[model samples]
Target: MSTQTSLALWAPRLLSVLRIVAALIFMAHGTQKLLGFPPGSGGGPAAMSLPWIAGVIEIVTGVLLTIGLFTRPAAFIASGTMAAAYWMAHAPRDFFPVNNGGDAAILYCFVFLYLVAAGPGPWSVDAKRR
Candidate 1:
């Protein structure tokens, strides 16, 4: 098969992989915030506030995205959350993502947006449900 055809065939699977990996990483952030894993990973004891709410969102949406269940909505919510996180937490610190330490948030925002557009792709629960 030609390169283009091969790429097209594998792209869906690749997207699913991306979704799974991104969700896993996002979940780690939730774990750090809510569960306080890895010891001193900030987010001291899960108070009833924005960070805690963010952690809950991350965990729930991350799981949904990872499993490819309700992928679009999960990704959309995650994207919005990341955007909010960047603007509220990082943008005030500095203008650029690199300077403000919002690089991850920016990247997550875009990636989740892409996932929202792309859907769950092959090997996802969404695909199976369809």
Candidate 2:
């Protein structure tokens, strides 16, 4: 195939991989919360009301993302989930990106927002059916 054609074909595949990776990452986080795995100081997986809700969202949306099912809605939900996380958990912090303060949530919100707009693209279960 022409290099351009090959690149075009590969691009969507790469994005699909990225979608799955992002989903899995968030899924693990949700599982951690659901299982009550301790996070950093003052943040354990016990039974925090807020974390429980976040965990449910993360798990549901993450699975939807992984399967590329209702990609748009799932991505939208994930975006909101991350946004709430940033505002509620990270806003009060003044640390930089790697400081484990609020940077991660802020970054995650942006990334998930982008995914919401981008959709799952080709190479996904959604694509296979259509």
Candidate 3:
């Protein structure tokens, strides 16, 4: 196959790889907030607090997305969470995402948004169910 065609053939599989990697990384952030694994400078959030709540969502969505189960809805929720995180926590610090440390949040939001529209690929449980 031509290079272009070869790349196109691998696209769907690459999506799965992207989802798994991103979800795992996302879960790590949640773990830091909830379990304090690898230990941050301080303890986790107070119970039911915003950070704690975000951590919960992150873990749930991360697991779902990683497994390719409930992929679209999970991605949608994750995307929204990242968006809110950027606006509430980062944007207020600075207009520039780079200055505000919102770059990763923005990237995650857009990537999750893409996954929502794209759906999980043939490697996903969602695909197998169809």
- Residues 12-124, candidate 1, lDDT per residue (tens digit)? 88999999999999988888888876455444544778989998999999899999999999999999999999999999998888999999999999999999998988878
Best candidate per TM-score, number?
3
Q: Which stretches in model 3 have alpha-carbon errors above 4 Å?
A: none
* Candidate numbers, best TM-score first, in rank order: 3, 1, 2
Residue 97 displacement in candidate 2 (angstroms): 3.9
Question: Relative to the true structure, how large is the alpha-carbon lDDT of every model?
Answer: 0.91, 0.79, 0.93
Q: List the residue pairs that clash in candidate 2.
A: 36-45
lDDT of 2 by residue, 17-69 (tens): 88898888888888777854535344545465888889988889889889888
Model 3: lDDT to the true structure: 0.93
Of 1 and 2, the candidate ranking higher by lDDT: 1
Q: How does model 2 fare in lDDT?
A: 0.79
Of the pair 1 and 3, which is ahead by lDDT?
Answer: 3
Off by over 4 Å in 1: 43-46
Q: In candidate 1, how many Å is residue 41 off?
A: 3.1
Candidate 3 lDDT over residue span 1-130, tens digit each: 8999999999999999999889889888898899997588889999999999999999999999988999999999999999999999999999999999999999999989999999888788898899
- Cα-based lDDT at residue 96, candidate 3: 99
Q: Which runs in model 2 stand beyond 4 Å of their true positions?
A: 1-5, 36-48
